[model samples]
Target: MKKLFFAAFTLLLSLCSFSQNYQLISGDQIKVSKYSSDLDIVASDKTGNYFAEQRWSWNLRAKLYKFDKNYNDIYEKDYRKELRGSIFRGFYPIDEELVMFSTEYTRKEKTFTLYARKINKTTGEIKQDAKEIGTFPLEDKRDDFEVKFAPVSNGKKLLFAANVSNKDRVSLVTAVLDPQLKREATATIDFRFTPKQFSIQDVFYTANEKIVVLGKESEETQVGKRKKKRWVFKQYILHIYTKAGKKEKEIPITADQRFAISGKLIEHTDGTLALAGFYATDPKKKDLSGFFLSKIDTDKNELLLTSYKEINASMIGQNYTEDADDDNDDDSKKSKKEEKKKDDDDEEEEIPNDYVLKSVLINPADNSMVITAEISQLYVYQTQNRSGNMTTYTTVYSYTTKDILLIGLNAEGKVKWVNSIPKKQQEKYENPNITRSEEDYFSGKTAHPYFSSFAALINKDKLIILMNDHQSNNVNPEYGHKVKRVYNFKKKSNFYGISVDLVTGTMKRKMIYDNSSDGIMMPRSAYINGSTILIPATRVKMFGKNELKMSQLTIK
Candidate 1:
């Protein structure tokens, strides 16, 4: 069946028409603000109780939202004054107390200081009586620094990875902070850099307490050299530290070719690290070259499994040829003068089909990790005559394309297997007529491009996969067109969710979210206890959006 998709956002114009609010009843969730705020939600404990957050502002404040087991808002307080620092980074809820640290920059002395605090669960929000302790910023110029927390064998401790000194080589500094907010700063773990190149962008910690550093480096050029130049690319370095802050072992990447990089690290109970990120090829190889990566590694830095295999895009490009020809017609045929003018004025190359293809849990396992990515396709094609011979001269066409990437690494980092969700098997193989013509555009089919958003849980023996399909502003918003050409794709938002068996790579029946007359469907949020699920939901409505509500779903 052919479906209509458009952006008839004629009514959602009023700003006060802000969307409704939702709270995950069974999980620790914080409603930042009714309209806009820096942080929607950040750190939450395993049991889904107490959660800490960093407000999004230039001089933002850190707040804690402790919800009762029933999901009632119990306490709301601020901690900006307690730590007495201009800035704060690492934070989360723990046990019966809330433990967090602070870092500040002393502009006058050009120095940095770190501090910490342990508040009772009932401490009441950021009170004047709230006692504070521990300085983490280490009285030096920690120009480039970051702090994080991880589960340590002896107990949970803070892991600070920053520079040892502004003048010294950049190092990964570690400090252990327990529930009591006690500090046992480990010796600095340094990540060696290239000659005259030293800087780290960001870092993450695994369950086993190993650290993965991700960032780029740059080198200066000499005056008389083969033209001074500047190049930047991402690099990865792995490190394990002792309780005293000394290095236990280090594994560094030896890829001679460096390109821009951004990545995340997750820790597994079986002591392995799951890494998910994307890389690009040279600008000249844009068409013949694209990028894709999926890998699992042991805690010790051994490559467990990887899917960097190239995706032959020949089929995709060929589809563009047949489709492109449909744009021109015999009625549009031009005389010699008209044809020659059209050829010379033509600047836009023949565009190719762009797909944001991805998958999850390629190798499902009890301890397998979930990795998701978005690969954007951008391509162009041009034709050139092979020879100048009048009659035998044949023309050939070639294309150039670029891939933009975005990745999300699960909090725990590892999953049983990545669900290899396939792309649409050519148009005919896909559900019929999901695409429609653009009401506001020239002659061309404006497909309702789908962005697959998923919510997954790594349970004891299974990987619960909740998938949602969104039209993501793919087609143009329908204007005042009679048939809602542009408006066709506008309100076409239908959501779907599913459950999967990680060990067997299997899926089950699903849930669908429908839209309303006002064009809204805030679907429901979910929580998992053992194998049971309690979902806060909104039922499908015929003419209006559903009321904010809740329900339960059983997976047998």
Candidate 2:
């Protein structure tokens, strides 16, 4: 009895030590508004105050709620009266103020105006009326105008890029705004490429106060010899411009004799830039063979370092070996040739495709970087039903997010370690002939991509990857093990966090919270503030009601 008691005590001590590494603080469950279909915690302040947005189902207006540091409700404000007819963009939390951006299109003036409204963080009240910051003229009322806003300088400034076309000429108007939503500098850039030839992939406001525009240009060019040539080619170009809109430099990203796809640009704190992405040898095929990382010195117009690593079978835990037959007999040779063909086929199947760069993390202390990419694909199924001369067609769309790849690189752009976490999450959407309710259609309750993907939080020593998975996966010894697929994440799912050592590429998977007892977590909506990771959890009750809570995970 004494031996058994001592063993039980040891087990309990170990459990306590494991639990101390992570503290899960569950906020009190608050009753969601009946009229609101979706509730999401959008922003948080340094003082631990949480701000949530409750979106109405019937209209475009939204309500904002503020909770104290302890998760107690403080105040709620409905912006329907003030923001009527305006399209909501997003929330930008600056120091003590929360700025909301909206766009209004004036038919008479044929202009689209960007407006900003500030709300007091503590009082949860609108500080002033909407202020128009910038306006762009359109050729017609139906002309396409898109505005993309990104917070730079740690949410102290905003970068706005407007893709406007007039008279078949496309131009990008870039602007920088201060914390008060005041324009500091603006510039219009005309790349001289036709609207169909060039497309803007992303805009970055660098630490050096310069604007970097990443664009993709597509052209039809023959690749192979005269008879086997193809005409489909794509290249990515980077345009560096001063804050005042003056064009500084243009850099074209390319790999020798390879097609660069899904390229991403990372600007380090020291003003150096890195271009990283996957590459495919054959443009006609969708499979990727390797990834390349290139560091550039923009000021000197020189490539500092370039490294390429192939996706071999060993990297993904697959084995490929060519069979050899030493016998001089013709039958042995034939058998060897057949075995070699089979091995080649197996190796080709091991290569993964449909991967997009998800996130890039650079250590400020040493500039060591980590790149993450995920496999995303969409499959559609169509079915026909015929009943008594009436035929109906049904379409189902299956979206899958799987296999996250993590590559760690040293300060000199050399890859140190590579690992992949295998997970399969699928969300399906079916088109119905009958009309659905606004709450059911817009709430994303039935089919939402937010719960299908994963989120990552990185520190100096470890990288924590969060995702929803099947409950059975919690018992797996480590990541990359064969696991069941997660379907209908909102109804049944388990939240997991896989912590990876930055140097060794070792991983430890832990079940953070189970959705069965807690609430369904939206991994994409998770935000990290300092060492604490905040995620919003929601449980749908009967009659379209939602029970909302906040999950705060503090890394000890």
The top-ranked prediction according to TM-score is 2
Weakest lDDT window of 10 consecutive positions for candidate 1: 423-432
Tens digit of per-residue lDDT, candidate 2, span 1-556: 0111111001111243323255677666666654443445667865545555645444446677776666666777777777787766656665456788777778888888888899877776788989888888877546336667776776677777887756566678878888777788788887778666777777777776677777777665454335333333377777888777788888777657666766777777765677888877776435677888887665664444379888764455432221232131122343335435544543322123557788888876687888998876655456567999999977755566777889998887788898887776766555521122211211112224546788787755788887898676675333435556666565457887777887888787777776887578877777787568877777767586566676677766
Model 1 earns a TM-score of 0.53
Shift of residue 326 alpha carbon in model 1, Å: 21
Task: Flag regions of model 2 displaced more than 4 Å.
Answer: 1-20, 32-40, 54-59, 140-144, 220-233, 283-286, 301-305, 313-352, 379-397, 429-448, 475-481, 490-492
lDDT for every model? Answer: 0.38, 0.66
Please name the candidate that would achieve the greatest lDDT relative to the true structure. Answer: 2
| lDDT tens readout by residue for model 1, 116-163 | 555555644432342233333434544424444555532355445444
What's model 2's TM-score? 0.80
